[model samples]
Target: MWACKNEGEDARLYQAVKACSEFAISLGINIPTGKDSLSMKQKYKDGEVIAPGTVIISAAGHCDDITAVVEPVLRKSGGAIYYINLSGDRYKLGGSSFAQILNKVGTETPDILDAGQFKTTFNTLQELIKAGKVQAGHDIGSGGLITTLLELCFADRNLGASLDLSALGDQDIIETLFAENIGIVFQADASAEAILKANGVVYHQIGTVNETAQLTVKNASGNWSFDIDHLRDVWFKTSYLLDEKQSGPVKAKERFDNYKNHVLNYSFPLNFDGKKPVIDAAKPRPKAAVLREKGSNSERELANAMYLAGFDVKDVHMTDLISGRETLEDIQFIGAVGGFSNSDVLGSAKGWAGAFLYNEKAKQALTNFFKREDTLSVGVCNGCQLFVELGLINEDHEEKPKMLHNDSAKHESIFTSLTIQENNSVMLSTLAGSTLGVWVSHGEGKFHLPYAEDQYHIVSKYAYETYPANPNGSDYNTAMISDQTGRHLVMMPHIERSLFQWHWANYPEGRKDEVSPWMEAFVNAREWIEKLAK
Candidate 1:
């Protein structure tokens, strides 16, 4: 008969009471309740007079409520009263509804048990509780099962119980050790044999309660047990701080400093010359005319390779170039790196296009330069979208093509296999008869191209194919698509990231022969540009 101010609080009270009742019923203990106050009082007095081992589980509701009512009656009856106050941190069960909240935050499924298995296990447990055979049941809960088991052994005065965990099909040992569930408790001296006979319940008799305050477990292989007092001393009080003191603080600080320096100063090998050598050129390298944006790791790597292949690179921001201070005639190859530009809002590529279009002077310069084919403008990932939005590729309408959200409705960064289309376009011509493996990390990367009925037929003139094919659910399985002229290529995937063997799929052991083809593609593109320059 617990009263609460609101329905939510009432629900919590009901759950607490129901859990206590279930635990009592499993132990073959009965509690009396009645509408009349006198009858309830008489039942309490009789139970107290009987001198049975009674435990009253109550939530802290109104400071002196339990002390005023049940405390006196239990004291007179010569029984001990245990009060359980429900005021502490509350963690959601691993298999409960609250687990979905973690999925939204991390975008990864955390539960080891699938929905079907969880439902099956829950249903079986419910049915077993309904029958009178199960004398006591405990929910596997916080600090997980290990802590719960230790607490149980402590409470029962060093009584150990055998647990058969074999019924948990195909689950990892670590997962079982830390799984959580609320409203569950372990019951001592329950009808273990009858409980096992029930449908879908599998358990093992592993060990028993002892008088010496020790816990022991006997699995199929062997027996291993520990004294509770010794375990507490070793686990609770043992400290690693003493060892740290022996090592000395100055030595630790020096070691940590060295580690940080090693990480920051590390440089990868650019050439396969057997010996790792620092890339320091004697004379000043010729600088490329094009203004390059501050590149990411991938962009920087590609730019370095371009420098090796004889191209001048000047890193500049978009704002600096749009001020009319940077001229296009001086630049041979204008390169933009692959990254989430302008936060990838209003669809990918759209933002970059808007920035370029809104700038009157920059737009005029780009239009004049692009028409002459003197400047080779390249964009990657969101940068690719920028090229599309600016009408670098000939489009029927002024509106830019759209890149939609991934069909999976989640962001998945992974490597996929890709086959090149052998169209006569400048981009694909270099990639003909070759396949590539590239890394992709993007949410909105679906590419759409306009097609006409009579002018460019769907099957023949229009090239629409998906592949390392259609990772982001693009309309035509398009990993990369080019404009009609084939001079400007816009691709959503990041080829620069996959430049090294470490970035390749199944490197070292698997696909050992698969060197990143995108590196060669860039070099080849550079060679083509060099030829065009001549």
Candidate 2:
């Protein structure tokens, strides 16, 4: 594992880094690789901009087989959901996103009761997973149980869950249900109860997955049943509603109500034309280029996923191409990883796109790379934004699509659901018709497609019965798209994040023993690359 920290020069930043180092030391963690960009200040003629001192910590780890990993998706209806406590009687809402939503800021900082207890809890959970005891798991954070529990339910559209908070000894219902605390919730098989008890972990039987399509919680006040669909719309409301007008377009309650029953399947024919792949005995793997720019962050994980998918991975930096330090001459696959390149100025990835457009060397190299029929490209999040802006994603159209500010006024981060579409891009060909859970944390993610719908292939769409399942309120709930040729694909979600099961703090019970579906994206890309290589 490797850790990197970037801190703006300030007393707070210095102290925070010290505390972080102490925590890392306690965990026996080492910072082997890292980068730092200091002095985040800009001065204009009249006024100067001094941004808040901040520290961004990035970490990466080596996993033998991502296919053995789990994902946070609510599984079989009738599965048991357990909430495991790690903070020992501490459920603080200080600095919580939920508090900000309610226009309330509390002074108490959320704390870990004991680092030892946390380590024990985490290790025990891993033990259960290793023993095939845990079906799925998710750690509680941010908006608290309300967010966590709902996310579990949303993992599968077919689930309706019921929770009885009565087991949670006398406490303020609001605080108990909405406090941001250190804890994890997971589903397990009935037989795992023995192991859970032997482990001596603090836990509670909070809920049961059902088919009612409702979220029922029994509290001291009484039994409360919320229409799951309506709750979803409110849970994912586009904006912090000062009123209805800013709420944007919310799907009808009926849509949410029947979403669980809606069978979403597409039968569009695939149009891939290529000769059979011939893997040379001497060189079995094709070279895959994982591209990154200054602010690019997801490169490590994206590259990791591709490497796991059987590619000869190459780290490609935009600066290298622009300075003629490196070339994509032999690369078969090109991936633009996500990040706030150029600090998302003039819109997300706009600055990154400008570099490709203005730098003659970089531009020509990329053009030549894309012109190769065997070469394929995929862009994610900020990378997706840049591809659309540069006409890589929708070259077939005169007026291409654009990623715009989400109807949500601010950045919304969550593990959301999406379903693959038929006749999609080569990268998703094998994932068609499958539903998945992927992380989406972006402010400017909504898609503005000006061309006719048929001009491009829709790779996937949000499983939104209401507001947030659609996340960004994109047109047609579109989450990803490809160029007319299907070789170039771009998407908003972090598919690489779901490469392993543990990547999900809470995973689907039914899929607990299975690998994440997102791996198919890379698998499909590899297969495509191999075919073109022939």
Candidate 3:
């Protein structure tokens, strides 16, 4: 809140506060949190500069189920666009972006004339959302009705809309399309219309999602066509210009040039239902260890994933191994969780590797664990660096592989895809030929492979072989690799982070699955150990 000085000609600051209070009271909303600088009027050498007061509101609503929340992305087929004006006010352009651009501020401005109606509309929409009716949704804001319609088509690939602004009445063409009003434009199928009408919700069937990538806008004036791709690129240009300033010209353009070309494409295993398998409580749970150093933060997530996969997960810190407090004797599976171990001061997992390479007890425990025929290990992010540094995964190679800084020389954090190849890894063998989305976040995740690709048991490759999708640009586009025995593995992607349905960047609709396919890895590990024990 930039509350200007109250010593103005008409006490503008006091009036703003009064207006805000009245609106909130009418809406039954509280102004519980806000900070203000009421003394922003600066006194110059000659005169004073009375800055205009500005107040912006940040509203948050609680979600019962985040997965059920409606998205703003349009589906390819089976949806009709609808609009309901919640603002109960006349179309107004005063103080709007259009008016400001033209330097013409009219007397009246757009607002929610009926707060009760607005709330009713919101609650009605929530009911529709809970009923799985809302396909896509976007609010009408500054740039007005037409702009909001265009934005809904921009998010998805090859999506377009055939718009008909006729139902809004024979109002002025400019006012009907560009006037800023408080409303929402949503996409839903025919079944939702009865529920909306039963509640006496005022709505208009505006358009439908088209197959070809083109926006057909029809008004009383004329019919107009727009290229969605061209508009999307134009929309992204402003952000790209700012990115160029921070990330430099080359990298920014490389990102801008390829950001929209690659949408996430995934292929699941033939029988991989996204449901948590029912575990028999009477059976013994498998034992697994989640190893961590001081700065590690991902152990809890990894441990939770293992526990859910019918394993008794233990958090084993480096201190425990160094002090000989916890040996790998009872542990069947070990996971080196991802994080900045030792704050990654020396490099990614350099300090972590030193503890095992130099310390006798820690080194012996790890060596003995690797030697055990019953044990299995997998490393992620910094842990991947640790395994490479210690030459644990590639013991056969005299010149061991290394983990290096990403080709971008920046920390890459992305929810991306990994195509699991045909591999004999005990944990990943069943998941072969499956393309899954997982989280990848690390700076030095790039694999500097010294040996031939055929020599290593390459388990996974990235779905997209370019900058952000490939993330670290590992050799041969490798996202993960396993030892020849398939007993041990190292990868940059975090399967633990992507265990649930909400973890994915874009998931298939109507799934209602409790877990994502990434949970298969942990389940596979647990089952493998269980079978071996039998």
TM-score to native of every candidate shown? 0.44, 0.60, 0.93
Worst 10 residues of 2 by lDDT: 266-275
Q: Write the per-residue lDDT of candidate 3 for residues 1-534, one digit (tens) a residue.
A: 443434562477668788889878877888998877667667779997766567888888788988876777788765899998888887988878888889887878887787777777788899999988888898999788878877888877788989898888877878877888989999987898998888878899998888777999887777888899999899899988987776678777887888888688878888977788789999999899999998987888889888988998888999999999988889999999899999999998999999998889999999999999988898988888888889999898999989998877778888888899999898899999998889999989988898788988899999988877887878999999998899898999998888888877788766777998888888888998999998
Error of 3 at 106 (Å): 6.3
Using lDDT as the yardstick, the better of models 2 and 3 is: 3
Q: Model-by-model lDDT, in order?
A: 0.47, 0.73, 0.86
Taking the tens digit of each residue's C-alpha lDDT, what string does model 1 give over 465-518? 322134465655666666555555667667667665556542221122233445
Model 2 lDDT tens row, 1-534: 112132434556667768777777766677676556555667799986666555566778766545445456566743588887677756677777868888977877576666666776777777777766666677888778877887776645556778988777667777777888778888877766676678676778888888766788887777777676666667644433432344333423433344344433322224321122333558688789998888888999999888877788999889889998777998888899888898887788889998899999899899999888888899999889988888887676778788898875556577767788886588787768767667888888998987666766888988764455565778778999888788888999999887666665444433433346566667788877667657
Instruction: Please identify model 2 stretches exceeding 4 Å from their true place.
Output: 1-282, 504-508, 512-514
- Ten contiguous residues minimizing lDDT sum, candidate 3: 1-10
Best by TM-score: 3
Clash pairs (backbone) in predicted model 3: none
lDDT, candidate 1, at 312: 67
